[model samples]
Target chain A: MITLRQLQCFAAVAECLHFRRAAERINISQPALSAQISQLEESLGVLLLERTRRRVLLTPIGRDLAERANDILKSVSDLEEFAHGARTPLSGTLRLGVLRTLGPYLLPHFLPEMRRRHPDLKLYLREDPDDRLLDELTSGQLDLILMASAPRNDDHLTVVPLFREPLWAVLPLGHRLAAKDSLAQADLAGESLILLEFGDGLREPVLALCHAAGSREHADFRATSLDSLRQMVATGLGATCLPALYVDAEALADEQIVVRPFDAPAPARSIDLVWRRTSARSPEFRLFAELVASHLPTVVTPL
Target chain B: MITLRQLQCFAAVAECLHFRRAAERINISQPALSAQISQLEESLGVLLLERTRRRVLLTPIGRDLAERANDILKSVSDLEEFAHGARTPLSGTLRLGVLRTLGPYLLPHFLPEMRRRHPDLKLYLREDPDDRLLDELTSGQLDLILMASAPRNDDHLTVVPLFREPLWAVLPLGHRLAAKDSLAQADLAGESLILLEFGDGLREPVLALCHAAGSREHADFRATSLDSLRQMVATGLGATCLPALYVDAEALADEQIVVRPFDAPAPARSIDLVWRRTSARSPEFRLFAELVASHLPTVVTPL
Candidate 1:
């Protein structure tokens, strides 16, 4: 027979432990709250509060019951908020699954704006290679994934188009190609190109681009995190590729790596957000996605 | 607006994915349970269960709601059981307070039987010097206290009688008094009696009984645990006093010790059950107490 109104009234009184203060806070009349308390106690057949004019005491049993009431009320509140959020914008916990190659380029620009617009939003950013984030999102662990589209069909989610960002080639600071404004893919055919390890987001794209350019294979070095790849490139150990936004930052502190735009067919990668249509995404999630999409492209435009 | 009952119905339906099974388990008619779910949905202005004639599937948001529902239900169930068991007699947790002296003598025999009779009951036994349980009882932490009574006023709890057991004088198994039929307080004069350290529950009574016999400055040793005192007495050491039940078995265990009743106004420690006036000493706690007291006198029956 307990209603949300009753629970709200009870919770206020139980927490404040003062009838007048609880009533004042809840914007209800003190006499009404008192009458309601009397009615509630009579219905439950237990005394919840031992009140004196100047003191309030909780019976041993009352203390136990209050703890349960608090948990119940909180659960119900989450349910209501979640249900409402599902119909509007994406909200709650939005696990943004990202591709490693795209992550450093996109996140630094969009996250701050997303925070300003969607204050209730929480983003769990996971950067991996290829379509790995999409697979996790499909299995219900990760909520949404942002990655380059693959040739294989994705049955799990509805992929929405974001934007494509161009890729560039990186060489050591004193490399022979450092003085060039831009270079064709075949320009570095004789040199070994260091590759990232498996599941590296750009592994397939670079391989396909090279295969089309009539190269059998290039000298290969594999690295995982971006900093490691940058370290290899800075020491003139190998040539690797990068998204322009990553290298466009002021000047490289190492001053040894020369990053140049790709001149052949202007290689670019598609970035998209894939989420399970069968999964609950709150309104806050939608606002965050929109905010990121709006701010990210402008930030990447200078590149 | 969702009651605990409605949430129960919803959870059952969600988990079992069957209305008939859930309704039967809850002891409600199928139609009635379905109506409650419909009502819950209408109240929340959201669809919680996705139902088709052939199957019932949770909506994406409904899946999230179900997890929250379970948490709320579990807490609510614990609270309801706690509240209803208040006067139901040891149905759940019983916070038992015992004097340090009484615990060794009483717990060994009682705990095993209590466990057999009330498998679900949880006994939190606390042993302290005096009636510290009484303070806990008043503060709503403890349900009962097994302690020796003083002529002090207790406003919150009524006392129930526990068994009264006699005391015995402990000495080396083959000491001179080992063959005596019985000993008087006067016989203890000029003989040093080892006592428990200060703050022991039996100290006051033992000191009073010894002083009545004009046995002054006769202290030999002081101990903490009764076991320590008994071990000291077994080593051809000075005498230490103990309740009849403890040495009733130990006397037979060793030929070096003797068991004889004290004849001159032997000091008696009355063990009583102290419970808060508002205590919900469930049925099991009361039954368990009776089981304990009934077995006390037999621990050291007069031989």
Candidate 2:
């Protein structure tokens, strides 16, 4: 029978591709780690790794098996988390994955308070790109995730809508649009717009807005972050749209840039708290989501 | 011959996994794109895509071939860029990849000046994680990259040292260490250090510093960006290290946070401008490197 320990050892080795480092990561002796790998291979009747003097590489089938092993390991971890949650609703460690765009701006508004209220709850935070955040949550590496957009109809997950953050137009101080109280989509036509790269959650909606306004994304620049987009705008490179929470957190005080709202029926993204459908901590998660919504900055409307 | 057009059409399809969207992305008719894919597959004598009414999927070998086709497309793009560069030294488009950690803080200091000096030059910027930046540069998706550390002894690239930016300890107001004039590694012992997540160029160095000082990273938190780290510190989560340029750019005025330099032999990261050795525009790139080094903020030591 395949044991969870074997899968854990194999997953570690697959990630590091070095037996010694993998052993160190898992807090085991080198010989013990090697023995488990060999034992698993013998039992399965398939070679999993190719070892050279200087490097370790996975076989083709080994690559596919490693992915499966990781999935199994994630399920086991989720089971353990379920057992822990049964004993204590919110006291144990909760691993949370978050979108890079939302984490920085949103967390500061509520993290300290959350920590104060649940002193026994330890939150392990990992912020990543949107796709990776979903991947990690599905793999059970994260107990929950906070993102601007949830999968439309993912059957395997539960999503709690937290808030709606409006996208505001940001421009250099002397730009022609800066004089307007609230810029309409048509008002932005013919302007040079800057945006985040394709994979960023904010990019598509911002691109759609630009397209609606007849504005073209600057052919020469795709910012990596909201901060980068702001920096470019400050340098007079191009105008951009930033979320209200982000603008409130950092840009409100910047004299070099101007932040204005869009006309009614403004572009906005829905922030969600998502977790696996099979999670045992659903009740606690719902309560936690309520807490987040209650404390959200006034710039965003709670869902 | 497998024409570039066929590969372009196939790569687009591989990315979108929908023929209509792929055709729209590449500005070709759906039938025209489908014809190219079929002709290419026939010549190669392999089924590249499995098409059904609802969706498209790549075959196992098709996935690998698609990656290769994309690489070839990138090289072709680079060849065109080379020809464009040959016509005018700095008048054409230049695609530059930048590290997310460095771009926001560093670019504003020089980008406006760069635009002023080279009016005809159109600079396209893409900011990505460290590994992706290097991969894109090697694949010819980017002509140049600016990063904290260059790959050592890489035969395929030329690296120009830019400057050394010191890491500073940031703390909440009224914290125990906030009163100190400067801090030594020993002073950080027993402190909880917040850090960027793994894969960020700055994370490893910050972790090393934490290790050297007997400090332990806050296991519960791994920030996605430097700004996120700052926000966490502001909320009294823990102390963190940030680059001097970033501090100079954003943190100096924050009333809730105090930034301090490290003691003698302060830990720092080396910034470099890197490009493929085979690039035809070395002279122009070298001149661009000089201009960047010259305009670096006073907080860093230009190399």
RMSD of each: 9.5, 31.9
i-RMS of candidate 2: 21.5
* Alpha-carbon runs more than 4 Å astray in model 2: A1-303, B1-86
TM-scores of all predicted structures:
0.55, 0.37
lDDT tens readout by residue for model 2, B1-303:
455677789999999999999999999999999999999777665556756455676643455567767765664454334333434556556788998889989999998888888877778899998889899887657878998788889977899999999999999888899999899978899999988876557887888898898998898998998888899999999899999989999998888899999997888888999987766567788989988988998999898
DockQ of predictions, in order shown? 0.14, 0.01
Model 2 chain B weakest lDDT span, ten residues long: B78-87
lDDT of each: 0.68, 0.81
Taking all chains together, the TM-score of candidate 1 against the true structure is 0.55
Candidate 1: stretches off by over 4 Å? A3-63, A76-89, A93-303, B1-74, B81-88, B150-155, B197-199, B217-220, B235-237, B249-258, B263-266, B280-288, B300-303
| Residue B68 local lDDT, model 2 | 67
Over the stretch A232-263, how does candidate 1's per-residue lDDT look in tens digits? 87877877666555666522444767878877
